[model samples]
Target: MWAAAKEYFTHPQMESFKRDVINHMRGLWRTWRSKMNCEHVKNHDNLEDILNDVPEFLIKEDWEWLVKEKFLCKEFKKMSKTNEENRALKTMNQHSGRRPVRQIALDLEEKLGRPPTVAELVFKTYKEGDMIKDDAANERHAKILEIMESNPDFTALEVVEAILGEQKRGHVICFGGGLRPKDLKSSTSTKDATDANLEAQLRRSDEEKEALHQSVIELKGTVSEQAEEMATMKAEMKKLQEMFASSQNRQH
Candidate 1:
C-alpha cells in the first residue's frame, strides 16, 4: 500500500487517514442499513419475500441474518424506540442542513471577531424561518445566555456540560462530534496511563543498556590489569633462575 501511494506520508498521518476512511465507510454502511430497515424490514410481515427481494449489493445470507437475527431482536426494538424519542426532541430544523456543526462553527469564527460559543452557534443553526422554532429551544437559549454571562471564560464544551450535564454513553446532546464527555475523559486517562507506562519502560531499557556497557568496560580493564601483573611475575621468576645458575657455576 505504501508503494502504491505516489506521495509520501508519515506513519501517524497514514494511520489517521486509515481511521478516517474506516469511520466514513462505517457511517455509510449504517446509513444504508437504516434506510433498508425502514423500507423493507419495518411494517413487513413476509420475511421470505423480503429475503427474495434483497438488494443486489447484499448477499442472501446476510439479508436473511439482518431480517431474522437483527431487526427481530428485542434489543434492536428497544433501541429503535429510544431513537424515535430522541428524534422527537429535535424540534427545530438546522439551517446548515446536513453539514457538520464544526464546519458551521469555523465559518462563524471567521465572521465573528472571535470564535463563537456553542450557544451562539446552536441558535444560528437551529432555526426555522425567521424565528426560534419552539419554546423549548427558546428556554435553552435563555439558559445558555445566562450561564455565559455569569461565566465569561467557559468554553463551548464547558457550556454544554453546564447546560445539559454529562451525556450518556454513545449519545451526544448537540452534534458535539459523537463523543460523550465521560467516555472521552476515560479514554484520555487510559491513553495517558499507557503512554506513561511506555515511557517508563523505555527509560528502564536505556538504563539497563548503559549498565551493561559500563560492566563490559570494567571487565576489559580487569583483564588488562591481570595480564600486566602476570607478565611482571614471569620476568621476576626468570631473573631468580638466572642468578641461581650463575652461583652454581662459580662454586664448581
Candidate 2:
C-alpha cells in the first residue's frame, strides 16, 4: 500500500512522510479496531452480520478469524473483563477521548515552550476540565510531584513506580498505554537538560543580587563618612565665630 501511495508525496520535506506513516500504522489500526469492537461488535447480536460488514482493507478470511477465533474466544473474553476491571480502577477522566494521548503531549510541549516533566504531562492529560475527577488522581499527581521534587534525577519510570508502588514492564499507567519506558527516558533526558539550564540562570541571578547588595553597603559607608566630615566642619565654624565675638567684645 505504501509503495503505491508514496508517489503522491512529492514535497521535498515530506520525503520521510512515508516512513512516519508506516511507523504509526499499527497504532492507528489498533485504535480503529478497538473503537469498532466497542461501538458495534460487542453490542450487536448477529456476528454473521458483522463479518459481512468487514472493512475493505481486511480480507474475508482474516476478518472471520479475528471475529471468531480472536475476539470471541474464552481467553480473549477473560482478558477483556480484566481490562474493564483495570479501567474501572482508574479515577481520572480521560480528557482526550478518542484523540491519542501522544498528540496531547506534543501539544503541551509546544504550549509550554519546553518538554514537560512526566508528572506535569500526566496531570494535564488526566484532568477533566479545571479539576481532577476524584481523590485518587489527585493523590497520584501529588505523589508524583513530591517524588520528582525530592529526587530531581529520577526518571519518568521511577516517578511512576514511586507513585504506583511498582513499575510494570510495558506501558506506564495514566499515560493511556501510549508511552513506553524508552519514550519516558527520552522525555526525562530533555527535561533534565532544560532544568540544568534553568539552574544555571538562577546561579547567575544570585551572583548579580549579591554584587548589588555589596554595592549598597559600600554606598552607605561613603555617605556616613561624608556626614561625619560635614559635622566636623560645622563645629569648626562655630568655634571661629565664638572666638571672633570674644575678640570684638574685648575691643569694645
Candidate 3:
C-alpha cells in the first residue's frame, strides 16, 4: 500500500488519485474488519497486511492505467467486480450503507439523558419498511439506532434536538409523541407557572383521595361497633322487662 501510494504521489497529476486510492483502500479495510466481526481499526498499522493480501494482478500496469484514466476522475466510480475487488467492494458498499452504532449512541446520550436498548434504538431510529430498499435513509436510521443503544433512555425528541443543533435541515420533524417543531417552540414559550400549578394540583388530588379512603374505613369501623353495642343494650333491657313481668305475676 505504501509503495502504491508513493508511486502515485510521485506523479504530479496523481496526488488526488493517490488520496482517492488510499481512501478506497481504507474503506475496504474497514469493510473487511466488519465482516470478520473485528473491532474498529485504531490505526493504519494493518494497512500493509491488507495490501499484501490483494492479488498482484490488481497492481499490474494495465490495471493501474485504467484506475488513473477512468475511475479516479469519476464522481460515482464503480469498483472492479473481480473476485477479490468484489469482496472488498461488498464490504465497502455495506459500510457505506450503514451508520456506526457507537455514533448513534453518543448522539442519543447527548440529547435524551440516556441511551436506548438495541431493539428500542432500532425502532426509534429506523423506518418501518425494508432497510435494503432504503439504503441511504436506512444508513441514517442505523446511525440513530446506534446512538440510542449507546445512550439507552434518551428521548426521541432529545435525539431530534441534537440532530437539529448540528444541521438546520427541516428534517427529523417528530422525535416521540408526534411533537412538532411549532408545538415544542410554543410550549417552551409558555410560563413555568402553569406547569408548576398543574403538577401541584395532581399531587394534592392523590393525597386527598388517600385521606378520604382512610376516613371512610375508620367511620365504617366505628358505625359497626356502635350498632353492636346498641343491639346488646336492647337485649339486656328485654331481659330485665321479662324478669319484672314474671315477678309481678307471682305476686298476683
Best by lDDT: 2
| Candidate 2 structure quality by residue, lDDT tens digits, 56-82 | 777889888888886788987898889
- Sorted by TM-score (best first), the order is 1, 2, 3
Give per-residue CA lDDT, model 1, range 97-203, as digits (tens): 77766456556656875556656667877767776776888788888889878876664445666777754565344433433455334323322422333344355
Please list the Cα RMSD from the true structure of every candidate, rounded to 1 decimal place. Answer: 20.0, 25.9, 30.1
Q: Which should have the higher lDDT, number 1 or number 3? A: 1
Best by TM-score: 1
TM-score of 1: 0.58
| Superposition error at 20 for model 1 (Å) | 3.7
TM-score of each: 0.58, 0.53, 0.25
TM-score of 2: 0.53
